[model samples]
Target chain A: MSLGEFDLIARHFTRPARRSPLGVGDDCALIAPAPGMQLAVSSDMLVEGRHFLSTVAPERLGHKALAVNLSDLAACGAKPLAYTLALALPRADDTFLAGLARGLHALADRHDLDLVGGDTTAGPLNLCLTIFGEVPTGAALLRSGARPGDELWVSHPLGEDEPGWLGDARLALEVFRGTPGLRVPGEAFDHLRLAMECPEPRVALGLALRGVASSAIDVSDGLLGDLQHVLRRSGPDGRPLGVVLDADALPRSPLMRAQTAALQHECLLAGGDDYELLFTAAPADHGAVRAAGQRSATGVRCIGRITAESGTTVHDRHGHRVATPWASFDHFRS
Target chain B: MSLGEFDLIARHFTRPARRSPLGVGDDCALIAPAPGMQLAVSSDMLVEGRHFLSTVAPERLGHKALAVNLSDLAACGAKPLAYTLALALPRADDTFLAGLARGLHALADRHDLDLVGGDTTAGPLNLCLTIFGEVPTGAALLRSGARPGDELWVSHPLGEDEPGWLGDARLALEVFRGTPGLRVPGEAFDHLRLAMECPEPRVALGLALRGVASSAIDVSDGLLGDLQHVLRRSGPDGRPLGVVLDADALPRSPLMRAQTAALQHECLLAGGDDYELLFTAAPADHGAVRAAGQRSATGVRCIGRITAESGTTVHDRHGHRVATPWASFDHFRS
Candidate 1:
């Protein structure tokens, strides 16, 4: 016997919130936004195996789902208010669901976001969370507001690290087969193994960029790939736009650089799953922007500039043109 | 090759909303509520083969997801404002996503809900939508405010045709056996068939019930089952509650009565998925309440009264006590 849907919701999901005038078990949760404030809303989904390893802890999965949605609101400079979670679990497990809810509530409580209303059902392991916040009108950042003269920037270091991890596959497979004493390079593990597992979402940096940055987007795709989105959107009504990247300005560890050179450096330019913020700000506001960057303890790099050239172009240290391949993830590539 | 997640979203969901200052493709969407108002938020999820038949059109699935969430806001007397959708599709089919987006947009436009930020992912079929609205503070209804003397009422009639349509165990096996020329009664078939498909969310009726109705909950589960939720919440300092139903006052069509009788008369009391509004109103507002109900054209029926007793008790036509099964799609019971 398993816990039914209604009981699961009652026991695990629908707990009364401290600040909520009306919380779970109601038709809708009611909140009074500060007068003269506008609400910001965003939704995101996390699918098992697609978004996370099946071996990942259920509690971590719940936390990530809510964390990612909250990060979206943070990117708009909105203070989180409430959220509703729609969970599709394979079956009813009281222990797993309780732990998941606990993790969700822990993060939500820290941010003052009340758990409002949502649905729970039996299905594959999928989590979709919709969150709400309030920001003063006309202040939230948008991706279409970047001007041609704006300086393109990123809140965290850009560049991918996949090829370095898969180095000498033949030798490594043979070593694992029988040679227990084979030594693996520590630098290789950091560039490859760590990068693939947990990608930190830059919540504080995104919120800090709101006032100064003219436009922004979360970097789920690679830097060059995602910037293409901002450039295309910020252009004059869907026209192509040019963005020039200073290859040297991209932050890279010594180990990463060596690994990239050995691997033809293509992976560094195109690998995905880095959940940082790519944005643009006015040249005059660069000092304040740089000051805000120090507060987050993450280096803000001026990587490029929005230009009217109508397409992306990368440059080497000598200012010569560099060829860049499509560096975004293709879900269905043979 | 199938379109990747980002491309799929760009192709089908990134349309410019007429009222949204910034729509999809943003970190977060801004919604400006009318001055001097509070915000209301609600969410719902629809999974294939569970909430609906596998054959239901994708377009209808999109509409129903938003509609159901909007109905929640309506129940709180909140006017529609904006919504964010999170959709997971098994494959990247442009036409299917387009039809689904069109359906969502059509209903949203009618209700003045601006499409805002959303995420698209590749996974099992599930659509989770969160809708936001604004209403006057202190006017939203809650389920904890019902008094013992308050009259229990429901919008529209009871008795869905799901049981008759799903057929008895014998009939279900017959259908699987390919019984040639076997026929279910047409009226029963129509009722249950309708039950198996679309459900009309009573948005307007719910909004009208606010202020007058002390407490409310949507009739997602059957009438008696949902009423138990109200009773559990409205009791004194966390005490169990009792409710008494007036059999004669339960509104149902003649066909519904026959259908229920055919299934041991439980369908009227235990059938779920009827998206009606179950509420409790003060006796003082009876006249105006009835007038409002007439205006909505959904018809309001006063069926019972909340009591301080510990458990539920139903009376038959001759006042005999009858045992009622407490199970209706119990999520814990597989």
Candidate 2:
């Protein structure tokens, strides 16, 4: 069916704003934040090829688009309220749009988030979602609040070994699935693939960790790179603090184990597209952190500690260096 | 300087979040709106080639990217609070970044809007801005509040004749100026070109008319197409409100006189990208509307009325038929 811009929005994007004062069709969405609450806002843009493979399922793309922004809110320990989409598409293909809308609605509905307002324009496929959330005033976990000696906890393990955590690897599956008569362990990669493509945002976990975790950041640009933000912001005594990741303590992924240790370390340390939450908490609050994890129904594991020293490193339990760390993914690394 | 994604954001996008509780470095920005207010949010995306030409200045491109979103806030009578920019660039070119940042900051500073948070990544240049504003709960101007007896008021006159209102004409100047050494009325087109390129959102005017106007929307799409939204939403009883446009009353521009009458009308009624405000008010509130225009220092014109009848029509002052209108600007209209 042919759809005009208005009809496209009405049919695929518009939803009654049950939680907001006004929604979809208006000039602006009216959101009434509860008293004593602060609004948490963040935006993420996913471009075709750069962000995902062209053959990836549209539903998964939609889920990941919103999921990435929600991950930001989660890192701040905010409860999702609503979100707006700014979509630029090459064309309005009905099947693609249907799958995309279904994926977005499935996740958004699960979080009770209203699709507020957005713009749809003609261009190469670029999807940007700006999500709105709320947290108790002054209670958001920021990257600046960690101190030296704080326990660094990850909401889950990182890398491809853990199919549950490899949402981005789903694209790899899509690429390899189309390989010319290629033979590979398909079933082994299935879970990891889906995990990479549709990684769940740790919203509930983030909310539960509030007032518990001293600082937090979502792992978008690999673990080490993202943690650098926390270290930079929460440096001890005006000095940039380094992080110490114990090689053995690192989350073990079966897919990662299949690779050489160096590659595994690289993937775990600097491979981005991981939506897991890496946070800090006082050693004394370990029990509380575990409890919060249970309450939120998400896993939590102590992976390392924030150090007073500058720079980041990976070491065995006995303190032998496994490898040197380099800069994580940079848009303009050169 | 060879910049990384982090440096690009730090150098160009990063600024102290004076108004926001938390800003750029965090997962999400935290904003505390004043009590008794609702947050009004909108997002817009501009893509190169689709939204602008390769010759367009990066400064102007950046300005329009934010300007379009701000126009939506004005239509809702919301006070600018903050905005998040999700920028995707093919490469990190320093000069382009500088110009874009300068343009964004200039307008943002004027509006007192803080660049609270955003994501910067590598891709073909696509800029998405999501603006946040505040209005007293229940006091927001909506497209659905116009009554049959309401007098239709536009923030300015419509059509190509009105250079004061043709923001899209800014590109036309660029077209003719770049015409392989062809000469045209350069100075005569300056004001119109700049006006179209950098539209001043009717923020003050919309705010002034908040309690005064019954229904409102910013004319991003052409006049007729946008008014259709009002008519659809604010109809009387069960029928859509009919709108009558007086051809003679449309604000005129000298540049428009160069175009044929049909082209002039087409540009006036269906040309998109005019960032003026279109609103309706009770006949008794005419004085308030006049006050708003004076306060905002922008032209105000009474061009029509909302009727109990259905559909829209354009006619001359003597009731002679002018033309029929269709959909405004659809991404997939073709």
Candidate 3:
């Protein structure tokens, strides 16, 4: 059926808002934070071809669009509230809109996020979501809170597990690209595809680490590259901090371990779209950090520690400094 | 100098937050409404060649992008707070970025709206702005509050003033398209271009309209079409409302009056991009409404009245029914 923009919104995106005072129909949605709480806001824009493959399904695209934005809120240790989605599509295709709305609302229902207010128009495919969440006053996590003596931890393992692990997306991309000398079993490839298409935001872990972790950031741009952001922002007294990551301590799955060393390093160190939480905590709070991960049902791995040195470095298993040249994905540069 | 995505943001969009607890550098920007206030949120997306012409300058494009979003807050009578900008560009062109930033910041500074957290990436040119504003609980205007016998009003004259007229954008587009038999003065065309590119949001007028206007909506998608939205939403008891608009009462500029009757009717009724406020108020509050217009230094004209009948119609100066087949601009249906 041919639907106008308003009709499409009514049929798909509109729903009764449980928390917000107003939802999709009004000129603007009204929301208020509860007493003694602050609203955390973030906006993410995803573009076709650059952020996702054209071969990706609409349902997966809708999930990933909201997932990446929620990851930002997770980094700040905020509880999801409501989100507004501004979408641009070349045309109003019924099947695509249905799948997209289904996927988006499924995740929203899981998090109890209300679809508030936004605009839809005809254009090249793009999705921009601005999410709002809440955190108690003076309790949000930040990247600048890391200290020199703190221990660096990650919410999930670097390369293990089929459900929530890094590097699977990169492996999936390589497989899609038909890279030479690479082979994977059919079941394993399906798992990798799922990992690439749908990423779980670590909201519960972030909420658990609110007071436990000193600093936090999500791994969107590769692990080492995201580490640099924390280091640059974490200086306590005007002196930038450093990191000495134990390369050998990085975890790997059976499939990842079977890959060539170069591929493994590239996927583990420089792969993007992981959505895992990389955080820091005081050495004395290491047990608390581990407990937080356990409470959230996510694994925690400590692969490095904050340092007073001015630059980040990695050491191999033989205790030698590794010469690394892999850079993180920069939208413009890449 | 060629700048990376991070550097580009730091140079152009990053600024000190005056009211927000945190700004651009953080994972999420934190904002809280004052006690007894609710946050008003709205998102608008603009894509090149659809929402705007390719011939438009970057500065004008930036200004219009925020202006359209601010207009939503105006319709809600919400005070501007801050906004997040998610931008996707084909490339990081320095000149374009500089011009766009300058224009965006200029309007933002005027409204004291903070530039909070947002994402920038590479893709087809698209701008999505999610604006946040504040209104005391139960004081915000809504489209569902109008009653029969309320007088319908507009913030500015329908078509007279060159600065904020309704049909100037349409006239400008026609001029650009080189429509045959159309002739506009050089100075008048320049003014029309300004009207089309840099719309002034009716923030002050809307703020003054609180409690005076029973229902309000911005005139973006043509006059008759937008009025239908109010009619559909304003009925107190689920029975729709109607409007009786006087055709002769619709004001026109000297240049507009010179146009053919068909072009004039289309431009004045179905023309889009006019950011003027269309509102309704009780007949007993007509004086108050006029006073608000005076206080805000904006012109308000009463051109219609709400009716209990369920369909909208227009009448000429002689009271003859005028058939209006013109439809508002719809992104999908053209």
When candidate 1 is compared with the true two-chain complex, its DockQ is 0.56
Interface RMSD of each: 5.1, 4.1, 4.3
Best by lDDT: 3
What's model 2's lDDT at B298? 72
TM-score of each: 0.86, 0.92, 0.95
Predicted candidate 3 versus true structure: per-residue lDDT over A110-167, tens digit per residue: 8989999788888889999999999999999998888888998876643356554677
Please give the TM-score that candidate 3 achieves against the real structure: 0.95
In angstroms, give how far residue B19 of model 3 lies from its true place. 1.5
CAPRI-style class, candidate 2: medium
Query: On lDDT, who's better, 1 or 3?
Result: 3
User: Where does model 3 exceed 4 Å of error?
Assistant: A1-3, A157-161, A236-239, A328-334, B1-3, B157-162, B328-334
Expressed as tens digits, the lDDT of each residue in B1-334 for candidate 1 is: 1346456667667667767666776777777766667777887777887776566676766677776787687677788888888878888877788878887877887787787877778888888888888787787777777787778887763234223221132232333346555455554544444443445566677677766888887766556767767777788877746677765566654444443342433545665666667788888878767876876656788877877775676776678775676543223210
CAPRI class of candidate 3: medium
What's model 1's lDDT at B64? 71
Candidate 2, residues B171-194: lDDT per residue as tens digits? 354444473432236676666666
lDDT of each residue in A157-236, candidate 1, tens digit only: 43343221212322223233454443446445433434343344566676677688888776554566667667776778
Better of 1 and 2 by DockQ: 2
Weakest 10 consecutive residues, lDDT, candidate 3 chain B? B325-334
